[model samples]
Target: MEAAWVNILMLILILALIWVWKKFNSLWLTPKRLEKILREQGLRGSPYRFKVGDTKETLKMQMQAMSKPMNLFSNDIGPRVSPYDHYIVNKHGKNSFIWNGQKPRVTLTDPELIKDVFNKIYDFGKPNMGPNIRSLIPGLAMHEGEKWSMHRKIINPAFNLEK
Candidate 1:
């Protein structure tokens, strides 16, 4: 009976250790490995920091850009609207990456790549948005996969020239 209890406790400890190892690998090791892979592929960008990543820097850039007033007639709003994106592209080539939290978002400025991405929508799915944000603005923008396709199909006819 005592031996059986000891065996059960040992099994539980082993399982706990395995769970912790997986958690660590997913949270830290995977991101570091991915960062190395991305760099090796000639993709340049900010180094990944634990947890928040480049979100702080992105927010700071946005705040600075917003504080500065641009010419009202200027058509170039890309710099103002996406200050971090503009900075990253200028600082680290157009094929650079940016982190929205833990996720790395590759900036594809080339028209060909942009078109390809649009054509192959499923290959690059939408980011996982939290329930609160999804609820705030519920529509086609918040949906994914077949639901998004269905919504687009339903809405496309509304904008057609014949209509």
Candidate 2:
């Protein structure tokens, strides 16, 4: 009986250590490693801030921008709608990146580069969004491979020039 209890405790301790390591790796180590890789590749942006990243700063900027009324004569709504993005673009140039929580979002200003990414669908994969956000906005954009093709086929007719 004593030996059995000791074995069970040892198993629990091992499991607990594994869980802790996984949490630490996912929450801190992975993000830091990704940040380092991006920085080394000549991309510039705000440093990763634990789990929250730049979400707090983004929300604050958005709220402040939206508080003011829009200019009737001005067509520049980018600043008002996406204040954080606007600030980032202005501060860090066109090829900069921003942290959306643990994910790093690289902003590409060149039309050709954007086209190339869209063309090579299999080469790049979409980032994993939380369940809450997924539930709120479920659509073709979230899908991949066969599902994406099916969804695109259904929606393509709506975007036809002849229509």
Candidate 3:
């Protein structure tokens, strides 16, 4: 009975250790590594925080920006909807990035880079959405790899001027 209890405790301890390690990597180490990679690539923005990320700051800035009424003639709604993005662009230039939870969202404002990213679709994958959201709109947006290619090929003609 004593040996069985000891074995169970040992197994639990090992599992707990593994879980902690994974959490540490995901919450801290991975974000830092990604930040380093982006910085090296000449992208600049917010530093990687432990857990909360820029969510609070983003919300605050957005609220402050949105409170002000925009000119009716102005077509740019980017400032109202996403003030953090606008601020980052102004502060860090076009090729800046920002933290979206654990993920580092790099802003690609340059036309060349935007075109390149679009052209190489496989290289830039879509972000994972929640199951409820995914179910609500599960069309081509959720697809990847060959499925996305097939979907795009079929859907492209629907919007083409020549069609």
Candidate 4:
């Protein structure tokens, strides 16, 4: 009986891991089919990075840019030393791909998803942050159930920039 129970537990754990990995892969892993999608539509950009993504490089560049004086940036970094902002400068041409980790995201220069977002913003849903990502945030954002709602309410005023 004990051996059977252990075996069952191990199987369940393995299955759960497989599920999470598959989910992460489907959303965040890839040689990114989006690349082809963009290419077929006629676009250009940088090659995608595998796994750890561009997050690390972006962060590094951003931090490096920030370390210098704001006024010194345009001169030092050649107009774009910051990470996110450099995304525009980083694009050697009109179209490009920026890796969000292993995932390749299509950068559409002419795309108006931005306007569409603000136009019918109410209809759109919150961006998916992947499973339990907030939990890793190391703050009240990790709370769930009623606790999360309460946390949000309590911290709302604190986060208000105007306040």
Model 2 agreement with the true structure over 44-128: per-residue lDDT tens digits: 8999999998999999999999899999999999999899999999998887899988888999886656655655678878667
Residue 158, model 1: lDDT of 50
CA lDDT, candidate 3, residue 80: 86
Off by over 4 Å in 1: 128-163
lDDT of all the models against the reference? Answer: 0.83, 0.85, 0.86, 0.60
Per-model TM against the reference: 0.70, 0.77, 0.77, 0.45
Higher-lDDT candidate of 1 and 3: 3
Model 3 agreement with the true structure over 1-163: per-residue lDDT tens digits: 9999999999999999999999999999999999999999999998988887788899999889878989899899888888989999999999999998998888987766865665577778886789889778877768777887788778666554466
Candidate 2 clashing pairs? none
* Positional deviation of residue 53's Cα in model 1 after best superposition, in angstroms: 1.1
Q: Model 1 clash pairs?
A: none
Weakest lDDT window of 10 consecutive positions for candidate 3: 154-163
Q: Candidate 4's error at 11, in angstroms?
A: 9.1
lDDT of 1 by residue, 52-126 (tens): 789999899899999999989999998999999998999999888987767688987776566556556678776
Per-residue lDDT of 94 in model 3: 92
After superposition on all C-alphas, the RMSD of every candidate to the true structure, in Å, is 5.2, 5.1, 4.7, 10.3
| Per-prediction tally of clashes | 0, 0, 0, 3
